[model samples]
Target: MIYAYIAVMAITTYLVRALPLTIFRGKITNKYIRSFLKYVPCACLSAMIFPSILFATNHIISGAVGLLVAILFALRNKSLVIVAASSCVAVYVTELLMTLI
Candidate 1:
């Protein structure tokens, strides 16, 4: 039963990924559609990641602090490493302060 479930999942995942490639043979030339598609991945990734970020730390406040720090760094066009490191530090400091209070 577990094997069957795994097989079904694998097939469904493969089809979802493969169907797009087989169907879209030509370049997508519509400007609106192209622009929408360009941001889709980022939107999807954020949707998946944002919730987890909020729950990753001991307290929600720390997670929010980290998110804010990350966003500020990102808006400033900082490097990935800088953004990530700063966010981690912010979370850590927030957690420490929360513990003290």
Candidate 2:
């Protein structure tokens, strides 16, 4: 049963990712679509980061600290790897301290 579920999930994931390329192979030439495609990674990255910073257990303090570091990293033109890693480390350290008392 578990193997069947895993197989289904794997197939579904592959199909969803492949469907767009297969359908749009030689047909995607709109300027707006091209511009939007360029921003997809940034939009997805923000979507993944914002909620965790805003709603974590410590709320204001944790959120502020993480947001500050993230902004600094962004302003300095740091790589995504550094920005994500630093923010995660800050959040983890903040959470650990919050739980200690």
Candidate 3:
């Protein structure tokens, strides 16, 4: 039964990825469609990552503070390393302060 379920899921996943390639053989020429497609990966990535960002820490408030710091760093066009490090630091400091208080 578990094997059957796994097979079904595998087939469904394969079909989803295969169908798009088979259907969209020609280049998409519509400007609006092109623009939307360009942002889809980022949108999808954000959707997947944003929730984890808020809940990864012991405290939601610390997580939010880290998220804010990360966003601020991103707005300034900081390097990925810098953004991530600063966010981690922010979360650590927030957590420490919360513990002390």
> For all the candidates, what are their Cα RMSDs to the real structure?
2.4, 2.9, 2.8
The superposed Cα distance between candidate 2 and the true structure at residue 87, in angstroms, equals: 1.8
The Cα local distance difference test for each model comes to 0.95, 0.82, 0.95
Q: Rank the candidates by lDDT, best first.
A: 3, 1, 2
Ranking by TM-score: 1, 2, 3
Candidate 3 lDDT by residue in tens digits, 1-101:
99999999999999999999999999999999999999999999899778887889998999899999999999999999999999999999999999999
Judge candidate 1 against the unseen true structure and give its global Cα lDDT, from 0 to 1.
0.95
lDDT of 1 at 25: 91
TM-score of 3: 0.67
For every model shown, what is its TM-score relative to the native structure? 0.74, 0.69, 0.67
lDDT tens digits, residue span 5-51, model 2: 99999999999999988887785689999889999999998898776
Q: Report the error of model 2 at residue 77, Å.
A: 1.9
Q: Among all windows of ten consecutive residues in candidate 1, which has the lowest summed lDDT? A: 48-57
**How far out, in Å, is residue 45 in model 2?**
2.4
